[model samples]
Target: MAKRPQQSLHRPNDPAMLLLTSLASGPKHGYALLKDVEEFAGVTLSPGTLYGAITRLEELGLIEPLESVERRRPYRITTSGLTALREVTREMGRLAKISATRLRLSGEFA
Candidate 1:
């Protein structure tokens, strides 16, 4: 069976993309991010997975920590993070549109 080019955007998805997308709305702590991601993506991320992404994002300067007195440290997306997120989603949208058009032209779309 033929697979859609758009399917590449799913499975083994980028944690950075999910994290950056979450931060797109506003700042959020680790727990908040977990909840938001689950709510939207229907995927539960382990603490390790979440922190691993968080560490990488920090290293890339895509996210920054906010001052927190409690154990829970909140983070906000940096300008660069927003830019990356926008570019990625825009590309995904473009690919989806292209795939849909092709499917329609082939009379495969229902």
Candidate 2:
């Protein structure tokens, strides 16, 4: 038997997914990440929530820390992180398409 491919364990709105999406643009430190996530996702993450997600992502090898600059440590998404993000993005697109189709059928969307 062949081994099946691993599926992404992230949900579109989860903190980990949000962080990965933000990092997709570029590397950012914790504070910058918090601001960017808020600006884009309209979701505000407290310091504890933000750092906790960062630590989990780092441990999963999805992200890596860069050299600290002026006391702020930045993080960049790893190759695995990019792969995971792409997977999740595709999944979200599919879900959105299905939702739109259903809504349209119900005359709820134009």
Return the top candidate by TM-score: 2
Root-mean-square deviation per candidate:
7.2, 3.9
What lDDT tens digits, residue by residue, belong to model 1 across residues 17-77? 7888889899999999999999988878899999998997887777899988488889999
Question: In candidate 1, which residue ranges exceed 4 Å CA deviation?
Answer: 1-12, 105-110
lDDT, each prediction: 0.78, 0.83
Worst 10 residues of 2 by lDDT: 1-10
Q: What is the TM-score (0 to 1) of candidate 2?
A: 0.85
How many clashing residue pairs appear in each of the predictions shown?
Answer: 0, 0
Most accurate candidate by lDDT: 2
lDDT of 2 by residue, 1-110 (tens): 53211243446668888999999999999999999999999999988989988988888788999999999999999998888788778877777778989777535433
* Global local distance difference test of model 1: 0.78
**Per-model TM-score on C-alpha atoms:** 0.81, 0.85
Task: Look at candidate 2 and tell me the lDDT of residue 18.
Answer: 91
